[model samples]
Target: MARRNDHTREELREMALASAERIIAQEGLAGLSTRKVATAIGYSVGALYTLFSNLDDLCWQLNERTLSCLMAAIKEVDETDPVACLQGCARIYQAFAEQYPERWRLLFEHRSNTDNPLPDQLSTRIGGLFEHIDGCLARLYPRIDRHERQLRSRILWSGIHGLTQLEHSNKLFLPDAMTAEDIRIHLIDSLLAGWDKESHHA
Candidate 1:
């Protein structure tokens, strides 16, 4: 009976999250409220409080889940070459944004002003992606100092994130402008070129 109860609770939590995602997808973040989520999930507001302390907590939970999914997708790449791995990571990141625009927006668009730290699990999940990029840099430029490597990694992450945001938001499509794929490929090439130039100097 205890096991069954636990299972049911887990299901309810999942349902609540699903309903929240649906609401966000349909009407954006402004549409997400405790009362609306409760109504959408056919649960009382008190029931939502059982799973999440407040609507902000629910938003954080959703963002964490989205990041987890993105990290998982990136980790699935099996390329052996370091440069190829980096490119693969870029492709996967773009794919995630294109495939899950709403979730992507929640993960990157919604700025949180709170001083609250991310849960350790979510931090580790995002850290893994950075670690992977750091590993590639180590292989590409073995003589670089730790500080230099960190700087390069941050640059790479920011470049990719910016390009992904532009492409996903359809901002790349100006009058007689490039397609999303064109922008993605160009950004990836530019990043690879920059890395190659840096490695030559290093």
Candidate 2:
């Protein structure tokens, strides 16, 4: 390892996070540990503790990056119509799960090693994702009041995540059936139709 003073605390923190991400991507969360991260980052376990409270904190930070990456992907869909934009973002989300299956699973599937709730900063990042969806749904159907729209966005997000999890588990289809992408698009279309009708009655 290089001399301890070669890197600042902030730089060491970044290095540790990057190393942890690489380990998780290659070996899933099962392969992550403070020891492994410290070894890869050229810092001792003691040094790592200076950066993160514990493994869970590092995990939350990694997941925050994953959320940012996902939000960036969906925002780049480049659709003009609000309905189309929302649908396009769904497709983008589907692709993201395919591209980074482990990272995607880590965000939702991995259980915490402790009982502590996520930190306030990380919790805000998670909520911001739903808020993004809330905005999109509001734009698509302005009659769907804010409270109602927020609830709907959570439902929509959960449904898509469930579908993705099923796909990863190799249980998305029969011998001959619509692909996962097809099913996702169909699900979105059906939900949008129902939401549109619901808005009129609001």
Candidate 3:
């Protein structure tokens, strides 16, 4: 290990987070522990606790970073057309899962306790993702009222999420063997078609 003074507290915290991410990616969240993170970062467990309340706190911070990374991915989708943009968002999400399976899984699967809920700030950050979809839906159907846009956004997101979960779980057994991307595009296209019908009816 390097000399204790070689890194400041802020640097040590960054190191610990990075090391914890690696451990989770290789061994999963169940395998993560403060001791492992401290050892990897050349800091004592007490030193780590000085920066974070506990392992749960550290994991929560990591989850926040993960969400930020996902938001960045979604933002990078270059399409402006509502349907294509939404489809691109789904494709980017699937790509993120494939590229960082462990990190992505931690977002949905990690829980400190079954009864305890996330902190309000974290919950709001998670909700921002839904807002991204809501914005796109609003652009696509400008005449739809805010309540209807919110409802449609939630419904479309659920469909995208369901498809992603099925793909990740590897239980999407079908005779035709459609890939995840294929299913994502089909879902978005079908939803758009239904929305068009609704708009015409209104």
Total clashing pairs for each candidate: 0, 0, 0
lDDT of the structure predicted as candidate 1: 0.78
Model 3 vs truth, CA RMSD: 2.1
| Superposition error at 72 for model 3 (Å) | 1.1
Question: What would the per-residue lDDT of candidate 1 be over residues 1-202, giving only the tens digit for each residue?
Answer: 1222444777878888889989888888778888898887677788778888877678888987887787888778775888878888888988888777887888765665576676677677777878888888888779888888888888888988888887766775556765655665676568768878877886
Question: Model 2 clash pairs?
Answer: none
Tens-place lDDT per residue, model 2, 1-202, is 7556889978988898889889988988799999999999777898889888998888888888888888887777665677777778777888888888878888886677789977787788788878878887887877767888988998898888888788878987645756887888888889989977877887
Alpha carbon lDDT of each predicted model:
0.78, 0.82, 0.83
- Cα shift from native, residue 126, model 3 (Å): 1.7
Q: Model 2 has how many clashing residue pairs?
A: 0
Q: Of the candidates numbered 1 and 2, which has the greater TM-score value?
A: 2
In model 1, the Cα lDDT at residue 74 comes to: 79
Candidate that beats the other on TM-score, 1 or 3, i.e. the better one = 3
User: Cα deviation of 161 in candidate 3 (Å)?
Assistant: 1.6
